[model samples]
Target: MAASLKMSDDKQETEIEEGANTSTNASPRPSCLTPDRQALADSIMESVKASVSKLRRGDPPTIYIVPQIIRRVKEVAYEPRMVSIGPYHNGKERLQGMEENKLLYLHSFLSRNPDHRLVDYLEAIEELKDKARSCYSEKVGPLMGNEFVKMMVLDACFIVEILLRFYPRCRKMKLVKQQREELEQNEEDLGLISAMKKFLFHSNGFEDPILSTIGMVYLLGCDMLLLENQIPFFLLQHIFKMACPVKVPHLLEKMALDFFESRSMPWNEKIEMNDSYYHLLHLFHSHLLLTPTNSKEEPNLSCIPKFKLKPNLSCIPKIKPVLNKLKNLLPCSNKAPLLNTKRRRMIPHATDLQLAGFKFKKNEKSNNILNVKFSHGVLEITPFLIGDNSETLFRNLIAFEQCRLKAKFHVFTTYLVFMDCLVNTSKDVALLHHNGIIDNLPGSDDDVTHLFNRLCIGIFHNFKGSYLSDVKDNVQKHCENKWNKWRASLKRDYFTNPWSFISLMAASILLLLTITQTFFTVFPYYRPRSQFLIIMF
Candidate 1:
């Protein structure tokens, strides 16, 4: 009986232990309270939250200056001189004189709207400060926090007031006249430019004893073109709205176009200037290329896929054929075509084309610089008015294109590249100049040629969507034609002058006599030679 009780007690103990084991296996440990696991989970959650926050900020499109491009070109071309528009050049000693003018303009703007407090302008600028900073590719440094906002406020109010000055009603106002007088006085005080030099200027390259108003305006205009020196268009619009509130449609656009009308092209007159432009430079660039009419003639590269090569070594039967294929695939291959559907091509320079019997003529009616055409041995290019500010204008435009994101076509860069290829030397520039296609007002032909050669040194141009591609192909084909070569040879060798013609005729006669002598010498034993000798004897 004692042994049976012991066995039963042991079995009960085993069953109880089994039930405990079952319970332990069925119920998971509460991980929520576990230190290590909870810490890991919390870390993962924090990481996800941080990522979401970053994603919400999104990637701002790059609208700032490309350092690589600026380095390749002249640094002075992208810099401001008389005035600095934005934070990039804000506080420079050279441009600080203009700061006083900016402040006075802002003061005038506030005075014009007596009901509007200065705090209202500050609040509007403050609201746009973060968004404006985000537009630039570089981060707005901590040093530029409040100072940057103040600069924007001052600059925006100044621009609006300047634009307002052009209005007919605004021009007649006493305040406007007084503001103009103050600006003139400031310019005179700063020795910026004399009134006589300002009024005397007509052409671009006219020499003046001192810094003229024309020079100052050109420099200031160039400074405004710099990518780093741009204020957001919306910020300006916001300030103009709060200050003007005149319900004038496209007030800023009208003001900008009127201010820089010399650089404006008639082709873009129909284009609606709305909210698409990011800044003044962007607006000016759009004015350079965009048109309202949709034409199939305009090259579209969107459908074309970028060229990429993949070598399948395993499928090749022989190394020789593979090597041959590779040679053609390589961009440096001499046998390969210089231009293809996927790549940019270079055409002969203006001098070479002229030598090859290609006639260059300027299309006076066409105001668009991109409207270049080649057909039936004639190359027609729209005249480009090169000026003192052209270098600055082109360099800034190129920098803008270089740093742009999702840009479908680089019209300005392509034009620069095309011109670079055409103007290889002073002789080429002279040809273009003599043909009235280029207005060489800035400097000599050599200077213009050198400028163009260096302008597109580091810029890349895709010919697929470029209007110049067709012109290039036609010019290349005409240059490569055998008949054109023969004609050029005749022109150079036989028809250059009276002396050249006489020499060529003399050479032809000498060649005929030599051929006759050679024929007799080779056939000395022939019947023809003996018969001719007997007849002569």
Candidate 2:
């Protein structure tokens, strides 16, 4: 009996083991958990609770370099080579070379502000640590706590010192002749500044010194403009104030504009610098786009002709409800629907448009690149200067608009997209080149064609809602008008010269005479066919 009981107990234990295994493997929602499983559940619950608590707070700004935006074609364009300004690119091995320069500049900046101690700068930057962190889209994991604060202070100081040295008036105040020479003695230790001095002063050593100098400056400027490589503008402002309390308003912004001002394309309207900027890149974008002080409307009287556009009302009712749902889902969305509109190429290629009796004129009235207008058979385009840094400048601007300028119409993207649509071939580029609409300082027509084509590759926007929508529709309608079509067909098909026109006229006359003869012969107003034949004989 005791042996039988032991066998039964063994069978029961094996059955319970199998049941537990089945429960664990069969479904994720188990009725019971072991000690180890319970511990894991508790840990996961805690983690989720922590994340939820963080989510209750607001998200950081969309200022980081989104991984999806970085394409393989020009991956280096979005990356910093010599220096990393902010925490996003900090501690990167490739960018470590410039850390020494940052430190040197930091030391110099602190020395200039003798009244304020280094601890004061650190304390001030530390106070803004949370605000600065909130400006980046990503969380600061590797660079947490004191490291983050130190990075901000050093980066801010470096920028202030560089700007002070770069601007004419600020440079005069910061470093006199003797002080500059003294600073230059330790040039080797100053990483980026050392290379910059060589690039600025000793470019004659290179094969193409002019091109080399331009390229170096372009690269340096591009490095600073990288999305991942930026510090907060407020930090810079705070540091600048600490350094020079008596400076005029917007001095920091002015210095930045001076540093990255495009030689080919200058700002159309004078912008009153204000503290309402995000960073240097944002400032540059605002300058180029003429972001109004108190308005969302872009003022381009030249582009705006006396033409009107009628919006498509037929589809609004159907799309409105869905769009309303999306708006609820996504607060602060643009008033316009997110569109994947394939914009109609209004004007044909330069040569084709010219052949169709449309004239190409260089529009000098407005400096805005988007200021393209068609009026009275004339297609006027503002001069677009393509130079060494145009690609870098345009790419960065487009990327910034993509990441930060939420819901706002992408004017720059739309303009580039329009240009890309117009220039589909080398012939189109050549026509624009001939008309002086495109000043190709970079290279050949093919190069310019490829550049424009590549620019709008991944760009998407609400083309219908853009400011140029009316202009595009007008140009398309003008191109497709019956009168214009007839004129173009006549000129292209029949009017090669006086000879062709004469030949066509002669052919027409001969055909008319033949038809008349046939008509008279076939239905003769005579006695009969036999009588007619006899009379003819």
Q: Rate the local accuracy (lDDT) of all candidates.
A: 0.65, 0.67
TM-score of each: 0.68, 0.69
Candidate achieving the largest lDDT: 2
- Each prediction's total of clashing residue pairs, residues at least 3 apart in sequence or on different chains, is 0, 0
Cα misplacement distance, residue 418 of candidate 2 (Å): 1.1
Worst 10 residues of 1 by lDDT: 195-204
Minimum summed lDDT over a 10-residue window in model 2 is located at 331-340
Which of the numbered candidates is closest to the native, going by highest TM-score? Answer: 2
Which residue pairs collide in model 1, if any? Answer: none
Q: Model 2, range 163-262, lDDT digits (tens) per residue?
A: 6655664444442333344445564535434333332232122143212365655666777777777888999999888766243567688778887775
Give per-residue CA lDDT, model 1, range 1-537, as digits (tens). Answer: 989997986786566555545544444468644556555655665555544444457846445856774555687777777777776677789887888777666666776655578889888788777777767766544326788788888888776666554434542344334435555466453342332122112122323212335555545556667777788888888877665523346767877766666662334555576786789888888877863221224223245354456865443234445456544543331333222223343676676567667789987766667667766767777787778778878888887887783445577787788888788889888889899888877589888987898887776667665656666666666665555655665665456478767766765665556556655655565667668789669
